[model samples]
Target: MLSPESAEIVRATLPVVGASLDTITTRFYTSMFTERPDLLDGLFNRGNQANGEQRRALAGSIAGFAKALLDHPEERPDRLLSRIAHKHTAVGVTDDQYVIVHKYLFGAIADVLGEAATPDVIAAWDEVYWLMGGALIALEARIYAQVGADDGRTWRQWRVVERREETPDVVSFLLRPIGDDPVPPARPGQYVSVRVRMPDGVHQLRQYSLSGTGEEGLRRITVKRVRGGEGAPEGEVSTLLYDTVRPGDELTLSAPFGDVVLEDGDAPLVFASAGIGCTPITAMLEHLVATGSRRRVLLLHADTSPADHALRQDMERLADALPAAERIFWYEADAPQGARTGRMDLTGVQIPRNAVAYMCGPLPFMRDVRGRLRAAGVAARDIHYEVFGPDLWLGEDS
Candidate 1:
């Protein structure tokens, strides 16, 4: 809980700080990168930086955390913190980096706020920052311990045993550990970070959801080549993986770490996804099939077309194997025999009663589906989602 004096200051200054977060975050990234360019080489995603997504996400998170503290003084935002901590652990973020971030972040704040950033103001916000940071540090420490990554050595070499083309733009890699180190236990809906050296010799990191069962010994990640359009730059790591790194090549992978894992329950499951977001959903389905789950499953997906769907066959085959599973797909063009045409519309679709839904896709798509699911009587707490990149929708529901 925040101290009384600090809370009053934060409450009074939140509006100003929140409004300028974008500028502050931008300045923070610029100044930090100017001094510590090495952070961009391996830790930060240069593509996200170039596109401004990382800056925006940081701004949103800061503003959101402050608002949550002020709005609910009695409780900490564990959900928000857990989401961020998982992502940080996936990228091998250590406790020391929080201090580095604090220095640059506060520097940017002071630089932007100018005269208004008094010592009292800075100290209050500093308390807020450390409160958020401390919670994250503790959560990440527990996660690291659970994954046996407490030593900060999160990366491991894995040999690609098989590479298969899933779609025109997507490929799947079946990987096995290169050493005798036991594979860390993975849960359905979790993801692993893939760190690869770019052509320039600087390593870049990207997270890909496990597209197969979470069983030990082997793992699979499906990659979709991110075609840069609409002012976005092409994904360097994805493009590199797509063009090169064939079977027999070794790639560095982190232990699977994600907060949005499949929950064990007997409730009906609703798995909804679009494009490459289907990876983790497919992994969950594989787990259910492997365990012979008899729970009712409703799988909904949307894509440009059946040809563009990365795991179309796998989805169909898995759903078919399940005794009580139904599959519905939407395509923008070339609707198949039983699938619907046009964008995803759940207006008349029958959502199973008491269904727990999991979604992974673009933000707008997820937001729309979430609203419809709520209208269809699924509780807010029952809806789960995963974003492939930095979470721009951090506090949307809250």
Candidate 2:
């Protein structure tokens, strides 16, 4: 916990860091990798660094922590720290390295603020950082302890068990935990990080949500390699996971974690997903059906081409399985082979007027989908979306 005065300093300083995020993040990572080369192996994506989303994520986390601690002091930080811990876990971040991040970030604050950053202000930020970092440190400590508990044999080494081409660019990796020990169960709609050595690009980290129900005997993730721009390659991690990473290869990973899910409600539930954004949504449906929920459900998905559609056969299975749930698929390709042709049309797709909308996708796609949902007269409180990156594409300023 931080003093209110210290929290105020943090609230004000976060705006500074948020505005000039790239500088702080560049300094932060530069310090981290230069000081500790091991992190470069699988904790970052140089290609994704060009857009500076990761940097923004770091900045946002700091800002959010200050706001949450000040706004909700009695709150335990699990709801806040667990998400970041999962992300860090995906990238193999340890508690020691988290401390290193704090050292450089505070140093960056001094450098960037120069004379304006007083000792009191610095002290304030120190409190804020620790409150947030301590939350993450504690969470990571528990996760690592869980990993270490069973003689270091539990979940220590992960091997690729099966790989399937779900869509053209999107591939699903079915990973089976192999060891003398047992594999712990993972919830649906959570993600795991995969590590690969990229010669063209630096060693990178990317996350994919489990594409199917967990009891399927293997954990799966669907990946769509963003290309052309500065984000990801045509293959990116996909090329590495598909071509380079063979079965029986060892990859370190964090346990499954995410809070994004179907909330309890009698009102109609609307799930909207675009591109490869369907991964978690798909899992939600599987979980929903497996649990025998009778709530009215609507699934709306958008994709560029038929080749890029995810889980066509399984979606068909879900459609048949869930009597109250109806799925809507929209393809943007010219030759279109689905129910709806072209991009997601908020005009054409009629969501229940009172339905709670859960959405996910690329930034532009989300912007349009949200705009359309609003245009279609959906209430603001009902529209929920998650931006895959660090960027805030949700309520308020978004």
Misplaced by over 4 Å in model 1 are: 214-216
C-alpha-based local distance difference test score of model 1:
0.92
Task: Report the lDDT tens digits of candidate 2 across residue range 1-398.
Answer: 67768767777776775566567677877776688776566566765565666776776666667667766777755655666765565566666665777788877777777886799888987887777777777776676565453211222457677667786666776677766666555665667666566775566766677778455466777776555545334646666665556566666655665556567657887888887788878777787788888878888888877677877677668756887988778887753454688777767566776877877788888778778877777787687665575645321222
lDDT for 176 (candidate 2): 70
Residue 60 of candidate 1: its Cα lDDT? 87
Each prediction's number of clashing residue pairs: 0, 0
Please, what is the TM-score per model?
0.98, 0.82
Error of 2 at 19 (Å): 3.1
How does model 1 score by TM-score? 0.98
Clashes of 2: 0
The candidate 1 region of ten consecutive residues with least summed lDDT is: 210-219
lDDT, each prediction = 0.92, 0.68
Native-referenced Cα lDDT, model 2: 0.68
Best-performing candidate as measured by TM-score: 1
- Which digits, one per residue and each the tens of the lDDT, describe model 1 over residues 1-398? 88889999999999999899999999999999999999987789998898888999988888889888888989999999999999999888899999999999999999999999999999999999999999999999999999887745788999998999999899999998988877888899999999999989999999999999433588999999998888777888999999997999999999999988889889999999998889999999998999899999999999999999998999999999999999999999999899999889997899999999999999999999999999999999999999989999996565
Off by over 4 Å in 2: 11-17, 68-80, 141-161, 198-203, 214-216, 229-235, 245-253, 262-267, 335-338, 348-350, 353-356, 370-386, 389-398
